[model samples]
Target: MKRLLQVLVIIFPLAVICQPNTEVYLFDLNTTGNQINITNGKNISNNEGYDNQPSFQYENTILFASTRNGQTDVVSYATNNGSKKWLTDTKQGSEYSPTSIPTTKDFSAIRLDTTGLQHLYRYRSGKSKVLLKDLKVGYHVWNSRNMLVSFVLGEPHNLIVSDLKSNLNIQVDTTIGRSLHNIPNTNLVSYIKKNKNEWEIRSLNTRSLETKKIANTVPNIEDMCWLADGSILMGKGKALYHFNPKKDTEWKIIKLFDKENFDNITRITVNKQNNKLVLVAEPETTLKPKLENIRWIAGNWKGEAFGGITEENWSEPSGGSMMATFKLIVDGKVNFYEIETISEVNNSLLLRLKHFNNELKGWETKDETVDFPLIKITKNKAIFEGMTFESIDKNNMIVYVAINQKNGATAIVPFSYTKK
Candidate 1:
């Protein structure tokens, strides 16, 4: 006898725990107390591009939306440590709303975007397909058991639902308002409305589409997201807050950040891999700046790197100290030096260090040429100020030192020389 299909119960109060490598990443902001750090918040494609929508673990595997490559697309790291790989390929416009499904796999992601104004594409399995088109999609949610999608048409935005098994679509909401998200197991949707100058968090039933008010706060709300445990997480300005629906009150503010030093918290993502949270930070709002070519004298050298190490996409950086040996032979003259640096703990963006000159003044690399602009070779010691340039297009340069303080508690800097 064959078994019949049975309906599974919707599990409520889904408890989510932090994974072993739990990490919090914000932008180049200074975090205090229980604040999560935004370490590596730059576009891997260019030196002066935007690092929008950060979503990844501490292991250097992140999924975010970027337009640095001339197109708005979803990009991910090939490994826990690797270059950014584009997931969606559209030349006309860019993509947005990139979120990763918590998994051990490095490149696993589920991103959605509506670039053409007529379709919404889901980038997965190495390709993008029209998951929902001919409709106005406002927000979407995807999990292991079910998928929730929202769309807007005419004036008001409407919510929709689709089952993965049947590929059927159903409308959930018909209100003309704002943001929406799924609250774990409960068949309800949480949304925000602009009440006066403040925003209010509310809920709507999934079955009946009846709306219910939840919380009302300041107007600083921008990117709103929820964890799998039914705890709501959202960002207003530079700080992150957690809200509890049952208690009708705000929970502990998880990662309150310093606003002056860092950028605005544009988006927040929940990476379930280690139950870690990743926040995308940039200078409140800035344009893609022109980068100069990073220049370093042509020479033979070696180095080593460690500490402040993160697994998924670089996090919890307590030690990013490095040491590198710079050996340069220019115009029959030989000069040698060393550089040591200590990266900001729990932050990969700031690697502070001291500089000590040698026989060589400095070196610069541009247009595939290593230019040593300053170098003085003496009998015993050397004085050098070197620069290395990585041309990220017609304009852009990243500058790094070739020599630094000696003995002073440091290690070899293993700069991953990505040979162009």
Candidate 2:
């Protein structure tokens, strides 16, 4: 790739949505109106170990943490070529709840270091830097670049707003849940407070730091995501629920994930496209999707990203898998190349890819290709377990690849191209 074509952008912070410790799945929304019709469900994280806490980096992109390699770091999936890549590869400790910080091209998550201390970190260009310290943040959401509302782990587990610029902490309430979210196109952030046997949904004004109760969730739900029109979607034992504070006043059962299809679910998130639902479920019960569903990725595609022209060729899905190769040419020479494969793990589609150099020497050992889980698949767009891809039309496509380098720097690589 052409090193001179690099452009940098900053993004977000980590959002520790909920800690249920389960497998994550992707659900497609078939019908969207007053209600949601989600069908063709599939598991994203098919690993035997812990895979949870998914967050959207964009409408077509997703970022999450997985313990597939015995330690927790961030990984992303691209729906376009069915490719997966590692965002954060650290030996320190595990990272969680990767959330966008707003008004930037960077993102952050909670890092529990070897000493058992939790800090909020900002990641860019394949590296990570701590944004806040000394405060054990179990969960967090940023209303802006400076103001953040977090479910902090403390003597009583308080909800506090910390001003990054002034370094002041203001407590909002106590005994709150881990689901912290930003209501779209608004300055308000929402959180759940345990109210007796039920949980109440409350809104916080980022500017004033004032709080108000807006609605309540179904009997027992700790994970939820917002729809385009400000409706709330939550998941309980076997079904999905929704509550519209603007139209209805009560929590109602709306969608269900059958025991045969999914189980032991945790954390819920919607991709930026706002058409698919993400669920964290028990790995044992998660289902696999069909290969024909992603046949759109079987072809030769070319794009410009990471300062060079990137060309990738993929085979049609067959024999339970597909194969592909990647090359980034700078000037007139190849800078880096890659080998990729897409297949099924447990019961879900899994994308694994390994990077290489100009001499065809593999960058990663023969045993590993970064793994990305399948998030959702659409006609023109598909989100793998991590990043996102958008087809403006059949002839053009856009891709975003989030990279967290081993050196502790981070970058979100952008690609643009026309079908050749």
Candidate 3:
């Protein structure tokens, strides 16, 4: 147990603090004839905190891990009326990857306790018992009443087949991903076989222990589900793609939820009847204010602004601030100078600047300074109230400032710079 905990904490952290805020969405799926149509999409897990790993518990019920009281637990949602029921509430541990057990009313999930003991357990009416005590099962699926295939956490996670009837465990494959499901209308189970250059969806024959590649996955996407007609569905960003191994040459986009702002799509599953679909995604959020997010701006930069050559030297972030000095030169003479600082204030960022003439005459009063509070931050842009800093690459950048004109209007002026 201790060794298993060490592996889990190193490879995949189960703690609540490490999880991101996400939601689970349900959609009505229609795969009639050659085309597919998805409609009536709704967010089933709409609460705050982490909610993911969705699976169909029954024809009209969906099971997933949801956050409540600062910890994750299994929750079931009804597709008919949008109702929910908590299945497990443990104070010292959390449950994830809940799935229905074949030929039984009970379900199973992987539980991670406070002491770092991770194992798969079966949940009955109100009690639970460990299903696989020795292996730290990250995700699993039931092949039949007596057979199970699990993705066990390890140095390179292994895919194991456990027979409950004979108490036998066999390692079938290694270096696999978490998405696993029984292929419909076949005696095979599907799993992701990860490789160095690409990942492929492969099938494992439970009887012969044979494996074969089905198709290469959508680049870096591991989560997927099988339709009733043996077609596969996978989500990436805001788009859902479909692949038919028999006829399709490559994965093709079937639906795009661009207007929904449902980004980072993962962990998708379809119901047994192929009429319902559930997916997990992280919604777009405002970036938090942190100097670490914009530390790439610290360097010597030269650019052109105001019809002259401008230069700025910035200090690395320290003492809750980053300081810089800017100078503008034109016609072989120093035009003006500016002193600037971006400081941490009240849990946010505040940018302040003071302007001076070439001869050191103050343009503003002794206490007056231009201020621009931080608005948001993206992967390459740091936006303030009236100013923005955009990094094009390691050696190039652009700064856009709102400048007041003589006509009592304001215009955005761009300053392009190259790192020195």
Candidate 4:
């Protein structure tokens, strides 16, 4: 008699919870008829944390929010000198969307407090003042010296025009993405409108408060920029594109960076001189690691190891992750348990495990877990940082666990298991 295959279920991380770590890049921009040349490309924000939403404050400076200091804060970087400094250092909250206000020495950013309070704040002279008290601003664009348009967070997030002096907040539209920008030398600012599942880039009359569609974009983009010659450059995935509403019929790839070498290219901006183009992007991801080759290990198995009977139960891989549990039984009594997880991180696969006692109390602290990085993989055998798994057959497998004995002798303990 043979056992039937069992279908296992597990929860995937929420979209809001699992976001890619992004970094910003800079490039020189040049254009011809329908093609653009990008040269002198360099990574501006190389840290691992969220370094995104880059906005050109001057021809030589960019402001963006970064999590390098644990909590997100606005950081200023000089493009020429490679200098950096914290623009906002509030201890109680994380700040985002740092934009330099036109005609002023001050800047503005969205301060997200730990108590669930999000507000637009003005920062200048080492002081901060709340700009909007009743609305939670996610992104904003300065329309003039005293007025600006904002993407206020709500059920679907709405677009609003806020008067800086009077503090009047007026909702202009609903269901908008965060690509807000002021058209060059014009009173119109551009925004993305979510029309059902599709998105359209529209221009808003800052004075009259009217809107007109400029160009329709692919779904779910919040990053775009206005070029000097009336062209719009937008980011989608690893590729960057430019569209001219008057000449071009559709968006075309700018050939700025190779698509295969980049990931999540978004939040683009150009300097006032139109020579420097900057973009926020995550680097180096082709696809997540596939688990099909490791399917032989996805089952319940029992074996003798560590002077005890070890039972291991592994769940099928799904949603870029798999899970397993192991128990060590001595004389028909459980001695210890181990929780194991296999998931993709930073474009690579990793196996993490933690031990627990018979009473289910975790041996590892809440802040730390043992990690095993995938070093190599071949057919039915995979090698981790210091361990390896080899499958002799579908029912038989061996795990070479790296260990060091108390006598200072290093050895590999092979745990051999057969499918139950």
Instruction: Tell me the whole-model lDDT of each prediction, alpha carbons only.
Output: 0.42, 0.71, 0.87, 0.77
Comparison by lDDT, 1 against 4, better one: 4
Better of 1 and 2 by TM-score: 2
**What does candidate 2's lDDT look like per residue over 123-233, in tens digits?**
897789887676778788887888888888755678889899999888879988889999977889899988777788888887787889888776567678888788888
Clash number for model 2? 35
Put down candidate 3 lDDT per residue, 1-420, tens digits, no spaces. 667556556745544545888999898888887768889888889889999998887899989999989779999998888889999999978999998999898999988887777889999997999988889888999999779999998879999999998889999999999899999999799999999899999999987889999999998989999999898999876567789998999776666563464667989999999999889998765456888888999999999977899999989999999999999999879999999999989989999999999998989999999999987766766778778787879999878777766866455566889999
Q: Which consecutive 10 residues in model 2 have the weakest lDDT in total?
A: 4-13
The prediction achieving the highest TM-score against the true structure is 3
Deviation (Å) of 101 in candidate 4: 0.6
Q: After superposition, how far is residue 287 of candidate 1 from its true place, in Å?
A: 18
Candidate 1: residue 358 lDDT (0-100): 48
Which residue runs of candidate 3 sit more than 4 Å off their true CA positions? 1-8, 11-17, 286-420
Point to the candidate with the largest lDDT: 3
Could you arrange the candidates by lDDT from highest to lowest? Answer: 3, 4, 2, 1
lDDT of 4 at 300: 95
lDDT of 1 by residue, 213-241 (tens): 77764344746666655556676434466
RMSD (Å) per prediction: 19.6, 22.3, 12.1, 19.4
